[model samples]
Target chain A: MNRKTLHVVFNSLFGIGGFCNAILFPIVLETQPDSLAQLLKAPVNFLRQRLWWLWPASFLLAALAKFADKKICDRWGHDAVKEMLEILREKGFPGNKEPVHFHRVTLFKHKRWWLCWRFWPWSGWLVPVVRSGHTTLNHQTCFLAPDEADHAEGIAGRCWSTKAVILIPTEDSNMTLPLLNPEVNAKPHDPHAMAEIYAKETFMDTDWVLKKLPHSRSFLGIPVVVQGQPWGVIVVDSRATKIQCAKGILASYEEIARPFIKCLERLS
Target chain B: MTTAPWIQVEPSLRMRSEPRQGLQLTLFVPPHEVPQAVRGEFDKQLKKFVIEIRYLDDEDFKRETMDDTVCLRIGKNSRRLLGIELDTANLNVAQVQFQLKEVEEEIKRAVTKFLQKDQAQEERENYALAIKAIESKGEQLLNRSILAPAL
Candidate 1:
């Protein structure tokens, strides 16, 4: 049967079962009283006497199930994201004209309980790096690759929270490969603008990159901080016409990145 | 159109034009050079086309020193090339020549396809505003599909 129908049937069965156990079963226990019956009846009477107890137990069981599901999902999601990273590295940053690398991965915890439980019950992730840092860290380090460094700087200034999460999108295999690369090309039509846009909206000025290039058609760069400290980054590269990085894909990546950052935090 | 120096050799390609996202183009090249007649014939048959290109290298390309290597970007999404990877280790004259020809062909075909993609016209306007929004603030709207609650 269809999903909706199945849900309706299952829920109906549960409601009926619960009602029978709560109401009818007690009545049956009261009416059928034999020596053997009282033995079976004794437990039912005890439960009936404490009718309110069933309510809390049911609620607790449902809560436990949900908690269990979340834990499982988190573990699986973490493994999946890690596997994806490995695959991207193994593929050698496909499609990009430049070479790219991943420096570090991080996970962040959502402070608001409701928000955390609703979206990320565990935590968030981020990858931070010095996009254009040379031998010694200098403000002029910003000038070498003005566009990328500027963007990286922007992220560093505002979104510098050690607790914030970074998300990456892996569903679109096409975008995933390039996003994982460290180096990218600049085409007039590249999605640097879109990446910049996403960064601006999602991260604070301290935590995102804010630069653009004329020739860069598409580019990939990772955050440069983990748990509030400056870390490395991940990168992607590609050169297909008509490519645009969507907001949805990046958000998905963030989901996985959060937990990863948490794991890193624990290790450190 | 016929008089234009650049010819439309293949069908056009189109894509969503987001400022943060860009188009990618890949081209296939022959291993060896052919006669002028062959080049002319090939151009006539398939001079333009479009393909989705993702940038993979964001760091290495930025630090690339060799002009022959064409280190275009420094992001994780960067890859070597679309169809066939050039053997950079060998550094043979013939290989370089072949790769150069391929790059040129890819660019031409990509540009033609880009122009044909009419959606870019509108997207460019939207992306411009998005850039402005980002300039005002550091964050932009991220896709919700993949977003889960932060831990």
Candidate 2:
């Protein structure tokens, strides 16, 4: 069968499984009486007496199941993203012509809810799908390390709690990558304007460089748009301070974005 | 609270002249951020669009909330479209609130789209303006050269 059909089937099964595990199973287990004799003893009285345990039990099971569901989805999504990155690497990072080599291609997944905490709003995280760059320093400082447990909590404390991904939803536009060199690009608040033009593409300039990784000069990112919504960003950063932007770079970024968006669409 | 069963009514079927709450926006257009003339024109255009734009569920439910008010026609022809009545009788408070949020998102999206469209429009106009300015300056320079040689 084709990839699209396979994707639809996978989604159907995932949804059904999620419903059964998170809703149906918990409710079925929790609502069942411990003893039939108790119900027989008093049908109306049984609800009043047994409901206390059943409510909490149902909630607990449902919560656990929901957590499991999110974890499963995250794992599946990470794999799909990783495969796309590998494909991008194989293609030699298209549109990326001389002096603008992709030192590293990073994907930052935006977790709308922090650890499934609905009330906490949005948080962005770099998943361990693929990485290519200077091995030690770049890996350590650029992306979130696998063992970085307190990062989310640390983000919560800062005033700049908003992730770079947040810019995508706000400003939505498209343009060629190289057209935005500092010399010719005279637009004030270029970051904000870039957010719109390359609404899909995220650019990490000086401020972001200073804050996140001083090693990387500029980062070009594109949103992985799945089903008309942005799922995450595919970022390509250069270790050099200035990089040439050209038509080939735009074409390459677009090519990478298209497949990345498609893979995420399958997950959606 | 009167528990009268609320029936969904088509917004178009309701009286257009009925007193309803209008969508109010407080835009902060910083000085020199946008030319006053452009900002003024944008404000007027945006207000017109908001009023003219149909309600969020207008297509599906035949509703038209004038000026971004979440007014719903609960009953048939002989219905009231007043704000208090809309909240108490016509609309489901919870559902309307939720729909209002969706409407807000749509409006924000619309604003972004509009700004982009407007920016493109301004760019074209600016391009034309630049050509006109250059042409006029070139003509003056030519005229000066002709006058200088004659003198």
Candidate 3:
């Protein structure tokens, strides 16, 4: 379960205990005021009464605090993802006129809990891009946002909930193409074949391009480099048919991927 | 291909580049004196580097001036383009130097700033959440305090 849900469950359980204690403590004080006076003094009855109620009240308050925290986290998490998606919408695809849809988005940590939010129209994914060597998300991830550390663990988690094809552009010389046709071990030196592999790996159906079409698919991946070392990749999925993916689009995507990458880069 | 390299002059400047083809340099000079100063520095600095120096002057400034300024151009084959402007009319030596330093520092700040910009909307929402959480807790505590009996 996600942290927000786990927190809510824990808070509810604690709230029940708190409610019982709050109700019981006052009754116990009212009934056993005289017995309690024998232990201390009748003049100190007020103190005793307060002591009896404070424990439960404090517990109840704690439960309330936890509940509020969960609510805030839920809202913030949703808004964060929404804002990112909106940016993509406004920016649109770099060069392709075809409308881009976010199929699936997720936020997950290697060892810690994972939170996945699924949207119907277009899948939006938000994942914690951890550093190259680190296995767990921690307080450092909080640096990415202002109040991310307010929680007990000091870090939030997210995951994508969609299945979409990612377009990989072939222009960037630095790009190391992912193996598309596993059957063909040989790297297709032919640009046409490479484009076909990209199309096949990305699109579920080949009907989009029946034959090996020129510039049918473009591959876009943001390199998350930390300390001059390549760490991870943030892949962009687009299905623009007319315009080919260009440098400007790549640059814009780089701008979007930067924040998450830096946050992960800073994590120890 | 035939345009002469633009040269500019300003107070207290430094230029450096490696040997390459098609490099463009645009320089901005002060009203009058700044151009001479920039030209002097460019000549000295040019000897140290393999870059071609272009001096941008009065007429170029008139034609291309977005506002009230002049720009110089210099380069070979036009591979690299650098635009330099002089704001000596409003900026002093110290201010100009500070600005140059600021630009260098901006490169570093850009790393964080770009990240912040990337998640600016998200951060704003997160801030709202944090404020709400704090406010709710505060209100609850205040209510309890008010309901409590006198000390």
Candidate 4:
């Protein structure tokens, strides 16, 4: 059945079960006498009584109703996201005309320290859930610290801010030159140069202020927005600097990010 | 066990000579600002770190001293460790790791600021040198045309 019809049937069953428990069960229990003999007799009377079956029937219905609830949640958990994407194609998503696409879509939840990502065909299984809050700074897998501002693995964490992006302090004039222009920092520059600069600089400053992660030398980060407000960032990094410089990487990152935002919106 | 990098320095002769010796780092709290009890309580929360408050007078005032200041000294107990006196004020253990992190950030900021200032100065010097070269070349060209061969 369609979602709307299923929703209606579930609500009606729940309402009838709630009314029976709240009104009928109490009236029947209270009318029974205090004496043991009368209590023993009560059961026989209930068997003959007009509304005696209603109490047990209500409980049975409530159980069935709960089962339906779980079933709907499990079914919608996967399909709702797919349906939302189809809707985005027809009606358009908040501001963007097209969806974002990166290697995998990541969702950084609000208020919670954990972020989750589920790949296609993987369903709910084996999604890498990154918990930055519980992670120690020097831990082998701990790349992002809880307190640190957002940054792609390749670029120095200090480079970009909501206000401005500073020049990477390196011997390479090319990297520093591009960042000096405020406009270039806001938008991605020549893909090849950015990839090369980020990779070399990350390697150069391995022990420095940069938050270094393995095989994440070439990187791009785009803000994942929800309802015009900044929710979290979608960061894509690559070990291969040469591959990152190829055209369309930035657009792909944006495309992958869009539906992921829609999924967060639906789940929240 | 190897000593942490932050504890590399030896205590100054003055500190070593002191009767009551322990590891100590003093924080400069401006005069009449933070109460001695509050400072003591903060130190107590650190558990292993002991807190001592010293009221500063004119004689005690050094170039580094701020007005209305008290110093908090954190150190290893003399009874616990024989004679490995630490000269450094900053704690380096995992318990005080955040403080070490702050020190790292402070160093990075100082270095970045120094480099930026140095770059600006170099840019100014290069601009001046370029102007001087252009002026000299123009002068030589004029001199050759007016006083020597025009060819």
Candidate 4 C-alpha lDDT tens digits along B46-104? 22222221111001111111111222121121100011111123423233223434322
Candidate 3 runs further than 4 Å off: A1-57, A72-74, A94-167, A172-218, A223-233, A240-246, A249-268, B1-151
Instruction: Report the poorest 10 consecutive residues by lDDT, candidate 1 chain B.
Output: B30-39
Instruction: Please give each candidate's TM-score.
Output: 0.26, 0.32, 0.29, 0.30
Q: Which whole-number lDDT from 0 to 100 does residue A57 have in model 4?
A: 86
After superposition, the stretches of candidate 4 with alpha carbons farther than 4 Å from their true spots are A1-13, A21-102, A111-217, A227-230, A237-263, B1-151
Q: Write down the lDDT that model 3 would get.
A: 0.32
Q: Write the per-residue lDDT of candidate 2 for residues A137-173, one digit (tens) a residue.
A: 2322222212233343211111012212111111122
Which candidate ranks first by lDDT, i.e. highest? 2
lDDT of 2 at B128: 30
Top TM-score model:
2
Clashes in candidate 2: how many? 10
Give the residue spans of candidate 2 off by over 4 A: A1-49, A93-102, A109-213, A217-219, A223-232, A238-259, A262-268, B1-151
Candidate order by decreasing TM-score: 2, 4, 3, 1
- lDDT per residue (tens digit) for residues A1-268 in model 4: 8766776787778878887788756755665544448656677456337466777788789778767855684456345444433332222122333223312222232232323221122121111222112221221221232233444232322211221111122112222222312343578566455544444554223333223323332333333334433444423333322222212332233333345445555453
Worst 10 residues of 3 chain A by lDDT: A154-163
Chain A TM-score for candidate 1 is 0.31
Candidate 1 docks with a DockQ of 0.02
Determine the iRMS, in angstroms, of model 3: 19.9
